[model samples]
Target: MTPPRDVAVVAYARTDHQGPAEGLSEAETLLPVLHEVLDRAGLAPGEADFTCSGSSDYLAGRPFSFTLTLDAVGAWPPIAESHVEMDGAWALYEAWVKILTGRADTALVYAHGKPSAGDPRDVLTRTLDPYYLAPLWPEPASLAALQARALADAGHTAGPDPAADPLAGPPAVADGAAAVVLAAGDAARRMCGRPAWIRGADHRVEPHALGLRDLTDSPSTRLAAERAGAFRAPVDTAELHVPFAAQDVVLRRALRLDDTVTVNPSGAAAGPLMVAGLIRLGEAAARIHRGASDRALAHATSGPCLQHNLVAVLEGDA
Candidate 1:
């Protein structure tokens, strides 16, 4: 792919992100961030050429969770829009493709989920293969634990313990929401003085059966990273979606990011949910926007044991 002529993230916003999200409705949880992005870009909702979002009805304990969010955008006179049951990162990808096809020049992308509303583990099982995998009741943590063990057996440690080996235990989960605005060419230049140009973006999926694949390496992520042209440019910072601390090492190695690249400075203890990976991309873009870094890499993951992955490279003007 020649890559889009020019598509950059002009604005980004996120929620306070507490577990369970308490009494806030989905629309309430998302509206503020959506407005924040528009405000940052100095654009109105109606100005967006297209709008798309990602959310799961299963998370809200009701179907059509996104339908209500359309009200928050006040989609009067209707608009070009779409939804995904996946994370906002994928929604961003979908919107990016829309621009590439010459269908829209700008897009608003957002995503939200309340993992606290239900047993996130139980709900996550629905992502597995319905006939074969869902029946086994394999929650995400247990599956991630298995991957952690594989890393340990291969001499990878989650902590400093030479023998303690971290992935031998369970992984952690967090909840949150994220939003970003994308504009093309002249629109991008008009929105922000320092737009974070999306140099490349790609996503890939692995087979559903964990037992049938190699646990040590995430080929899906590796391929996506390569397709995103991460190797073609040097990265000064990398925000990886590593729910399990050790997966950070896995992704860094996969993308060949090393000491020269600063990994997540946001603190390892704070992991956000569905939006976490996507937020990594937004954070990387922010660094470029602020002149804090010249080039950066962002990654997002899905499925049990990191079976699905997406990667994008962001670069600022030289």
Candidate 2:
């Protein structure tokens, strides 16, 4: 089969992460970020060949919540647009495929969430096994702690007490939005001095039953990383989307990261839902764009206990 077209991230912008965005509507939250990324990429609104978004309607307490941001970027005159209910990173994956398939030359991707508006624990519980786990109403921290405890018993250090540490637990859910701009080939080079070319990217999911999986090892993450070409060459930096600090150990082991690789310099903390993953990729790309890194790896996770994973290997032009 022919190789996919080379895709590169050209620009990125993120809002200030906070506990609550009470006064700002989704459109207000996205307008500035949309402008910044496009400006950085030298694109005006509706200029990109395609636009995609990642956001959860549950987070917004309405269906089709993502469409609310469309006007912020000027959807008038009609543009190729789509949305994902998952993290912006996945939306980025869709955009990557869009560019790879020759469907579009450029794409704008973004995501947002406001966990403070409702009971996040209750909302998260709904994502579990409907017949078995959802009834238990397990808060995300307890579930992560269970995995962290299991990992520690297997020799990895225990993550911070899931309920005790607000920063490492459910309370850390950041309320913010982020955006990234992607372009192909010379257009990418023309926009950014050092485009962070996506060498490979892949996502994988494991058995949804938590009891059926091993908490100490991230098989899905390992498989995704391998398929994404992370093992083909050593990466100098890694931006990991670990919900709990302890989970970092699992990702490191899975990705074969060494001491030479710097991790998470942006200090995402708990990271905004549906947005942190995109930030990881953007942060990794920013490092490459500024000549701080030659090669890097970025990761994102969905579902509980790293049950679903996405990994991408990125390299800067020599």
Candidate 3:
């Protein structure tokens, strides 16, 4: 079998995070970021062999929400395009595979969402089992709190129970957009001074039924990290897409990250619905690009109670 092709993140860009933009369209917010990431990679529109995006129609209240986002990419020439109804990290995964398969040398991955446009908890419910879970309309944080409680019960709780404060203030809400450029082999080295080569990337999910999963643990994350080779070595930095404080604890144990690893200097505040995950990838890759970290981990999670998890291990030239 051929050895896996080396894929690296060459450039990353994201908009300033903030509370709801009074009336900004998603396309308006993403256009500049699209141009900037491509420019950083020294590419023009449609220059990449493939382009993919991650987003959701539920957040936009319109079917085919991703098509409008295409306006930001200028698909006039009809590039090899695709989209995922997921966070941008998943979109990056698609592009990574495209390069690894030798079908493309370079690809652009982007994602945007305006969770501020509506009540996010209400929207996130759609990710649950519609037949049984969606009807409950349980907030994602509430599910996380259950995990917090379970951790405390299982003696896995590292510190104060994050669930103890149900009356605590809600999480910070922000609209966000992000883009990343990926290249394979020599192209990656040329596009970046210290390219963050993807040593391993994998995502896994547990059973959809809430009762079928162990709320106190993230086996899927652990398995994904194992498959992604996260435990093969220590990472100097970790950018985690933590939806709740308790989820952070769950992720730490799964990734086996110790204090030596710096976590989320880029701020993991959940910006919009799908953008935060991609931002995690961009943040980790940026650190490697700048020589700030020789090795790093970028994690993204979706679904209720960490039902789905993605792990990517990155390292700079040795």
- Residue-wise lDDT of candidate 1 within 185-220, one digit each (tens)? 998999998999998999998888877888878888
Q: Which 10-residue window in model 3 sums to the lowest lDDT?
A: 159-168
Q: How many residue pairs clash (N, CA or C atoms closer than 3 angstroms) in each of the candidate models, in the order given?
A: 0, 0, 0
lDDT to native, each model: 0.80, 0.86, 0.86
Q: What are the per-residue Cα lDDT tens digits for candidate 3 across 128-160?
A: 888988898888778776777777788874743
Compute the lDDT of residue 25 as modeled in candidate 1. 77
| TM-score of decoy 1 | 0.93
Q: Compute each candidate's TM-score over C-alphas.
A: 0.93, 0.95, 0.95
Candidate 2: misplaced stretches above 4 Å?
1-3, 158-169
lDDT of 1: 0.80
Tell me the TM-score of model 3.
0.95
Evaluated at residue 56, the lDDT of candidate 3 is 87
Of the two candidates 1 and 2, the one with more favorable lDDT, higher being better, is: 2
Candidate 3 global CA lDDT score: 0.86
